[model samples]
Target: MLKEQFKQLAIGVAAFTFSCATAKAATTITVAVTPTAANAIVDLVADFVNANPTYDVAVVGSSDSLSKDAIVAGGATGPYDLLLAQSYSVPANLKYYYPTLVSGDPFPFAKDTLVLYSTTVDISQGIPLQLQAFSLPDPATADPYGVAAVQALGPEYLYAQGQSLTIKTADAGGSYAQVAYLGTAYGFTGKSQICTAVTNVDQYEPGSFHHEYVLGQDYTTDIVLAGVKIARTRTVDQETALTAFVNFLVSAKATALQHHCYKLPSAQ
Candidate 1:
């Protein structure tokens, strides 16, 4: 009788371990996003997990183009189950897994506008005489914002006129940081970025910066943001979770959060 009781106890323990492992596996989802939207995305994930306690989500953020490239390279079975990226790149990036996409469509999330930020207190002084350099994202590469910046600034005319506009380029986040902290005379970035800097200025070294809207005639483009989910190559449970998360992103609560951060929701 004692030997039989011990055998039953061992079986119960094995079953319990397997159940725990399976439950753990079912509760996690991975998402990739661009740096411009990282903060808002992180907040959204937190709220999502809180509302759905049974699930856990992780967010990975990088440059917009890089994030799209990584997801594309991963194909249908990539590390990420969903992608939040700039609107322009979504269609191209998800081309590989297009047929298998959750809805096979990209959902518009938000809109952003280009703006000019300057460390100088007054930008009305014609780009500041003390300004030795102008900084922006690289237009030749992956950044749509960079291309917009080039259209706004007309670099060729400035260069031809022998202006001391030392052109500097970096990713969007890097450009914002350089202007905010490194004393770059002028930097071009999204309006959301400038808003973030304004709200978080006290955390940086003592200084003042100003921002001006780059008119449509200047930038000649608009920025729209969107998100997409890859089809479930994992499990039906994961597919349901991904769909729910994507829906939440476009819901009123999430839209309000994005709006508070100076991003205009697509619905607007």
Candidate 2:
């Protein structure tokens, strides 16, 4: 009888322990930081997660789908607790349509700089094939960076001499990816691979490719990564899951993003 009684007590204790472990409330926050934000803020996300025991963090790539999903889904169903994106789209893309989804003010996270980087192909060596020799896409149509670049080029110069540059058009992706395409298409393969590559006359041929100035016109592109513009909300559960994830990002643990390379938007 004594042995059986002890065994029962042990079983009860184990069950209680298990229940306690599983009963704790868990919160997750998702962040859709742009490429710059990814580099800058990824570290912060880690830090935030470490400090907050009850929260989890998820980082998603920006696209229209992510933004629409974050808004349309409700907090309990397709919920996202917080979002951080570029400033340009908030009122038009997010705030303007909030009534159709959750009713509340969207939280602001950070601001960022729009910087341009490139690989091979040097313009100082010789004039570009034309004033706007490089290929790019239209900002109004789809490519935000391309739009900024065009604005930087100045319409007067670009339209000069009955010549123009090409701004290739495609669905949006990452900044490095865009730079990669620019380098590869321009025949600057090798060490000068655009984003990663830099032109060195001594390192390679004299006429190597190099990234030019990053036009400030397209600060909106940074929104692509901020989870502010896009997120994954195909289902109510997904949105809820993503929201829980984003909440963690802005929490105390998110200081890690600063260490990783993400500058606080306020730093600007």
Which structure among the candidates has the greatest lDDT? Answer: 1
lDDT of 1 by residue, 162-195 (tens): 7756454555555666666567776776665645
What digit string (tens of lDDT, one per residue) describes model 2 on residues 118-182?
Answer: 33444533225434344443455544454455454565334732463443433222333344433
The runs of at least 3 residues in candidate 1 whose Cα sits more than 4 Å from the true structure, single-residue gaps closed, are 1-23, 96-103, 124-131, 155-166, 196-207, 214-217, 255-260
**What TM-score, computed on C-alpha atoms, does each candidate reach?**
0.74, 0.54
RMSD per model, one decimal: 13.5, 15.4
For candidate 2, the per-residue lDDT at 96 reads 67
